[model samples]
Target chain A: MTDTVMTEKSELPVHMRRAEFDPVPELAELRDGPAIARIHTVVGSQAWLVTRYADVREVLGDQQRFSHARFLERRPPGMADLSDEEIAQARAGNLLAQDPPDHTRLRRFLIPEFTVRRMKRLEPRIREVVDENLDAMEKEGPPADLVANFALPVPSLVICELLGVPYVDRAEFQARSNRMLDLSVPPKERTRIARESRAYMAKLVAKAQAEPGEDILGMLVREHGDDLTTDELIGIASLLLIAGHETTANMLGLGTLALLKHPDQLALVRDHPEAVEPAVEELLRWLSIVHSGIPRVTTTEVEIAGQKIGPGELVVLALPAANRDPALLPDPERLDVTRGEMGHMAFGHGIHHCLGAPLARMEMRIAFPALLQRFPTLRAAGTEPGFRSFNVIYGLTSLEVAW
Target chain B: MVSDEQLLRVRADRDVCIGAGMCVLTAGAVFDQDDDGVVAVLDETPEDIDAVRRAVANCPSGALSISTGTPAGA
Candidate 1:
């Protein structure tokens, strides 16, 4: 066993070194003993890693004690890497970073557009989008990166359609959106991307306002009218466009990777298209793509699982860890498509749960089955690629599949 | 002939559902948008089990839930 060093809190690494999604080794180690332990972040912040199932659920479910707004207020140390203007932009666009009334208000504006009812109408269109990408994949032939060909565009097209974003400018939008997710990059670059994306979204929304369409951005303008300022509209649009595509894209590629790795489960899905509903849930649970829950701050001094959390401390809820905890899931590690686990925190819990979940699920259910059906002999081409380093969103760099 | 199996009603708390449009995309027969874009349950007791399951799975907010209560065959 490697020797455990009790070092100063300042010396801890802020970011995880191992690929964020590959937590098997960590799970094995934690399962062997204590579920919770102290881990140092590269930012020199001390965070308690809650690995047990019960603790994570308890922490996430209790909103009063654990506040999201307070956590966003306290910048994780080493954020000095960012410039003042960039920091200001982050603060301005901190809708998801807020709690309660503010969060409720912002979330209210977004919730209506993302409903299951609304998405159902778009099903055929989403299928068309999937088919379009698959058609490209087929044309491009084997050794093509699924990430580039299939995974990325499925959601990108969907979001573009939803928000009335011009498909012509998607390349620029994707580049800027990706830069926004890069935490390791200097703050200036991050801020620039954030600003550029917001500006582009604002332009899209403005265009929608001038000439409204049946899309979500048009609807938002029509509904809220004067209530939404230009910046807020841009902010909300940017959030939806980015959230709409990036996370779901990661899931599509990663979920496909997971299924490819487990041929037995893949065979089950292939054999039983009827099982797609439960299979998606099981895949979400097994992968837990979004590695950590949205960070919440301690509103008042509170104790969680016997640990004393001081007031105003930032707590990062580990969703993947929670979903995999043995206490909640019987085997925890195994991937059973039919496993009737209550539900997983892949989309998160409580009021702050993912707004784009329905669309993401729809994309997965449609894409996975269609792909399997279209290419019965689909298999990975060459050695599996590695995952991206530091970005909160977890996905393989590329998945080359061939029949 | 309606089987003895209880019919499942899927309802969405309008307060929770963000118009991700996913539910409709996944199972259109069960859910649809009103004139105002809020999700409304069209067929609380969907005849198809697969459609019902899709509606339940597609709900992003977890607002849509399935309930089993027998209604007198009308």
Candidate 2:
């Protein structure tokens, strides 16, 4: 209804992209009609936005045509003098910055650690992590900012533990990730944040290099010491550390709030163990916290959903809208935990699908149910929930709740 | 049906496998990931057929599939 076109390239691209837990109405209308539209991106680049379920899948599934690696090939303005090799080294082991053979090489080493068996081994620890946070919340009593007390810390702690980040570093690390994910922050400021974040991770990488510990970083060093470069280690660790926490953290915060808004759904997650699995899947699909997925660069000229695109063009997937498309499933807009396995694109699709998805899923499954069970009477209180509109990740900045 | 018969056949096309581990996460008994993040089927006819179905549905790449096969351990 309203002007959905982001007319100016310089305008803040994060403008009005929401309906609380749902995407803005304009996005749905786009998904229905055009299926694809050209829009100005947050970075001041014009890109193709593919919104419908099947069209988004086409982009995601065909990594050959839609290259994930080239998406990050743009040299940072500050580092223009750096050699191509140096720039390539910077993106070395980051999964999102890679594709196929390279992605397969580094990813294989990490996959075993994230396998369901590994997650199963981590389950008790996850349950313990969930219990520890819930215990603190219970002790703190009501009027707690769930974002600070529960949602943020649960995933933050879990990821830190998994990635071997020092618990003490979390305060500064969280602050950096906050700035990094928030698109509203100026590009120069974000570049500085990225440098600081990389420097911070580089130190940890060195520590693991000296004496590999039992964490993911340690495992990489212990197993692939001869194979990986220092930058590769840093790239992999930083990606996991940021992705691991930010994604699930928002899902936890916003997901808890979503259930609070729907007491009926909240009860299903808390009271019924059978419901927890489906509920997590449903929450992931419904929320689609990563509103717009990472932009892909076309490797060659290609047509998508009948739209033609030349080589080197940018293509963005409307993940939240795609998940909510009526064509994806029946009553797509409705938040129904009973409906699971509808093949939602929240974790995305194709080869570069989220590597931490299993971990994210496990964390939410444990955290959401535990939160509801701990505070049976949980409801919003104190501060009005403020949505973090600018952040690449969609979530509440603070969700004050009382039991 | 005999002990060696292929029962509860599950086919995995490693050609398309990106090794995201969705299948392994969804149906642990029926699917696993090799070191290189390719799909590895541990059980074709797991007790939890529904879980296997979910795994097939959840696969980011359409690499995993389930089909009828002969009985197991007859």
Candidate 1: residue B18 lDDT (0-100)? 51
Residues A1-403 of candidate 2 have per-residue lDDT tens digits of 1234665654545322786887878778777876777788866777888888888888898889999888888875444555787567668888888878888788777877777667778999989988998889888877799999988898898889999999888889999989988877776787678778888999999999998999999989998989988999999998898898788889999998899889898888899999998888888899988877678999999987777789999988989888988888899999999887648988889888888887888888888888887888999998799888777888989999998
- Candidate 2 docking classification: acceptable
Q: How well docked is model 1, in DockQ terms?
A: 0.25
lDDT of 1 at A260: 83
Q: What is the C-alpha lDDT of each candidate?
A: 0.71, 0.82
> For model 1, how does the per-residue alpha-carbon lDDT over A1-403 read when each residue is reduced to its tens digit?
2213233543322223344345646544653455555555434566666655667766766678888777666654555655675554454434677676667677767666666656677899999999988888888888678888888989999888888888889899888877777656666666566667766766787798898888877877888767766666777777778888788898888888788888888887878877888888888887777767566777788776567777877666666677776776588777888773335778876667777787888888899888887777888897676587556676777888888
Candidate 1: true interface contacts recovered:
0.42
True contacts kept of 2: 0.60
User: Which 10 successive residues of model 1 chain B have the least lDDT summed?
Assistant: B17-26
Clashes, model 1: 24
Output the number of the DockQ-best candidate: 2
- Compute the interface RMSD for each candidate structure: 4.7, 2.3
